[model samples]
Target: MAAKLEGGAYLSSFVDAVLEKLSPILEDDDFVLEENDSALELLGRLERSLYDVGSVLDDAELKQFSDKKVKKWLVDLQDALYKADDLLDELSTKAATATQRDPDQLQHKSLRELYVEACDSLKLLPLGDFPNLKKLMISKCQSMECVVVPQALPSLQYLSISECPSLVSLPALTLTVPQLEELHICDCPEINCFAEEFLPPSLKTLEVTKCQKLASWITSKGLQSEGLTHLWLGPCFDVKSFPREGCLPASLQALKLSNFPNLETLDCKGLHHLTSLKSLAITDCEKLENITEEHLLPSIEHIYIGEDCPLRWKLARRDGRPMV
Candidate 1:
């Protein structure tokens, strides 16, 4: 845009000048920012450019250029605005005595910035101090072994580890963030346990499918969550029993049970505490021999049974109320 400072150039012509300026900055042999850091470094470079222009340009002209600049406000702008300012200060003092190949002279540099780069073979991961994460999907990471929670994952809310066959364990939970409400640990054949002591109490939903050992989570004493409203426990063929009543503090509104081959019975002896039961569905549980009506949920309003099951439901109501 500097080429049009004479006022003859139309605002439509801004791209040519912007590109002209950007192309050289990219090619500068002294520009030594890593590919990832380039976004920030570029911002730093722009701030530097604006500062350089201030030597000959009036504050009004600089202000005009600044006010008219178009920004996408994506990674690029964040890099320039945030990283650029930090770079300005770092470089000002280090420029004279800086011995390390100044990234300013190179197109790229290596970064040990925030989180370690995902490796091809590493399966288990520890993300204790990860930066600005909103999602961490380790589904395809079949070789993972364990993950450690980061300290300040303020943005993280969604985490999934489906189909990780080799994962054995995850870090003990130290962060009880209510913001992280959705957790998916399905199809992880080897993941036997989670941080029961530190599991998020505010979790409202969990999907633990096909993970046979994950049944331990329901029984683990350390899990004190009371807020779950929806639960999907499917393909957990090894889970022979539901966590006995009173273990789950929340009054589950919707509970779905499916595909537990070894499950003999669903004894909700503790489920009486679940006063808010609204919908209960059971399907594909071939081994379920009985569902005692004595403790049949009082508030339960909806029921959907799965296919391939024959049930001889016994209504033992003393009042002789018509069976639902």
Candidate 2:
């Protein structure tokens, strides 16, 4: 019976699978007969109930570990979902054997964008179904652990995920979504690395904030995309130095580092190859002091140092230096 839905992720996955099964059954107009109207109505009501209950499953999953009541409630919910799934499966089998419709007609081709917010119970996103989707934004999904993009999304351009605390890694974007251009990630602390070795080739802008483990991951990975132009990283309290020699790609045009409280040094060897970089901004780094003269590359036209940094006054009054 539904493989005994165990963890929050598994339960959420099971619920999504049931919902997907119900979609085509409910969508087929021919399936709803005059005699079966009552059954169709019951299925419709069941769909609504599932949606209502699914919203809180993420929070409940977390609480279930500590509270026996939450665990029991989840067990009851899993049982109800299994029964609903069984009923849907029986009807689906009858419909498939009775009539055969063209599979191409069932595809959702025109859907271009999708946004999911605060779906605490959603653990996985079956993005392979939406081939034409261009932009996807997911925010505040506390229980979301993975985003499943099984096939290539040729049309996807921009993806932004924020406040997803449980997210462990992203789908291999460089291989899965080759057309992706912009990626913004914020407040997702658990993510340690990208699923793949490299970022998308089409990516131009990358911004990450308040993600300490991910920040360290990015630094260690060397931020090596050839097309990336603008980069912003901030509020990483553990970082003592940044852009460890050859960490940033030479294609970067503008870079901003902010709110790094423990940052003490800026590696000149790391900035040596950035011939295309024009604007550099460093702010809110209170302990920063060691920025040698060679750290300012010849290609840099504008530099901004916030007052909170100890080197602000030193750089401002330094002769022959362009300061802001």
Which candidate number has the best lDDT? Answer: 2
Q: Encode model 2's per-residue lDDT on 199-243: one tens digit a residue.
A: 887999999998888888777677868889999987777788776
Off by over 4 Å in 1: 1-120, 124-132, 174-178, 217-223, 237-243, 312-324
Error of 1 at 49 (Å): 36
The C-alpha local distance difference test score for the whole of candidate 2 amounts to: 0.78
The lDDT per prediction is 0.55, 0.78
TM-score of 1: 0.57
RMSD of each: 14.5, 9.8
User: Which 10-residue span in candidate 1 carries the lowest summed lDDT?
Assistant: 107-116
For model 1, what is the alpha-carbon lDDT of residue 32?
Answer: 31
lDDT of 1 at 26: 51
TM-score of 2: 0.70
| Clashes within 3 Å, all models in order | 31, 1
